[model samples]
Target: MAVAPSFKLPNVGPGPDPLSLSALAADNEFVLLLLQRDYHCGNCRKQVQVFADWYDEFHERNTEVVSIVPEPRERVRSWQEEYDLPYPLCADPEAAAGEEYDQPVRFGPLGRFSDLLGRMPKAVLLDCRDGDPTICYTHEGSSTWDRPELEEVFDAIDEQR
Candidate 1:
């Protein structure tokens, strides 16, 4: 089992600024970390919206959804204006957190240079009650559109419970 990596980034959403992995874990039973492909990813936008629509349900289960975009804080701020997401939307311009969690990148060197060209989406569910946050489930996308369903995430959390 993989242990979840710790990170702290500026939040551009309806939540706190400078959100940290440890704090998120401490506050919730589970943390659903959504790693986006890039700033303009349509699928990423849709996925966040879906999670926003189902935010209440997730909260009822003591799970917090956090969407991370590997773009500048300003770029991520635009999303907050457009989507108005209810959860934490973090900005990780350097992609340090994404790299920490091993978010997949294709196209070799070119992909590393440009996130839009190579980065793929990823979903990580962390069990946070324990002292150390542990990765309970992960869906690594082979393509930009390849992401797990909301129910699938819920089921994963339920199984662990």
Candidate 2:
């Protein structure tokens, strides 16, 4: 389940672009897929900033990194500008992509109202070569303050090469 079989979601970055797994490797040799909590989550914003800081380093190794959140495109735009993110951003306001990616979500004190809960942070590395996308690694954040280590992420990237 850690390995993404195939997933395609709409990009809310520069334009209304289609980010498809079918054509992944062709567009970029590899992609570091990031699944984030909603914009309301302060931890999520900080996590994005960390990624933004290391964006160039990832690209230098031929890995294109992008982030996705369960938020509307308009809000996503604001988040990108606020963080000064350099990579493409994807919006899944309905949380459809989050469910597709099997990203965990929580509701609140009452279980009845939990389905629409915010997202949990996570990341996966995809080896998109030979016109096929393969999941090389997956990192799950266990808590609000959890974040994947840059060294571990880069190690996974190096493993792909």
Candidate 3:
């Protein structure tokens, strides 16, 4: 059973420089979190686009969706504009939050590739109560292509209500 680690990662956004799942949530709110591999993954880009396309629906459910990327601030900021992401995006170049959330990483050949190349994409629904973050749903895989279905991700958000 994987658990969500309470973490506040620095983001590439303007006002909300640092975004934390716990802080973003209400007294008892569920946050839909999307963890991306990096700026390079095609699958990651597709998944993000999917989320962008359905951003309104997620909002209609009163669910807050956020994406975390292991890219530098400059690159992440550029990506934010490129995606025109309706949600928050945090930069984790050091992969600190990824390590805390137990986000997967490809080992063996893929792992040997490069620091920015070995990341494993993941998604999670976190229920933030008071100041603690609990994992309501978690999706971790060894390959970048391995991702949770949008339906399942939205379903997890619906569970909060």
What lDDT does the true structure give each of the candidates? 0.93, 0.74, 0.75
C-alpha lDDT of candidate 2 relative to the true structure = 0.74
Q: Please, what are the lDDT tens digits per residue for candidate 3 over residues 30-126? A: 6777788887878877887788799888778766778888878787888778878887888888777777877776665676355456778888887
Pairs that collide in candidate 2 are: 107-114
For model 3, the superposed segments whose C-alpha errors exceed 4 Å read: 1-3, 108-116, 129-131
RMSD per candidate (Å) reads 0.8, 2.8, 2.5
Name the top lDDT candidate.
Answer: 1
Tens-digit lDDT string for candidate 1 (32-138): 99999999999999999999999999999999999999999999999999989999999999999999999999999999999999999999999988868999999
* Model 3 clash tally, residue pairs: 0
Q: Which is better, 1 or 3, measured by TM-score? A: 1
Model 2, runs deviating above 4 Å? 1-5, 14-16, 106-118
The sequence of per-residue lDDT tens digits that candidate 2 reaches over residues 1-161 is 14456756667664337676665567777888788877787877887788889888998988878788777788887887787777778887776766776676556454223423545678888887755677778887666667788999999898778
What ranking of all candidate models by lDDT puts the best one first? 1, 3, 2
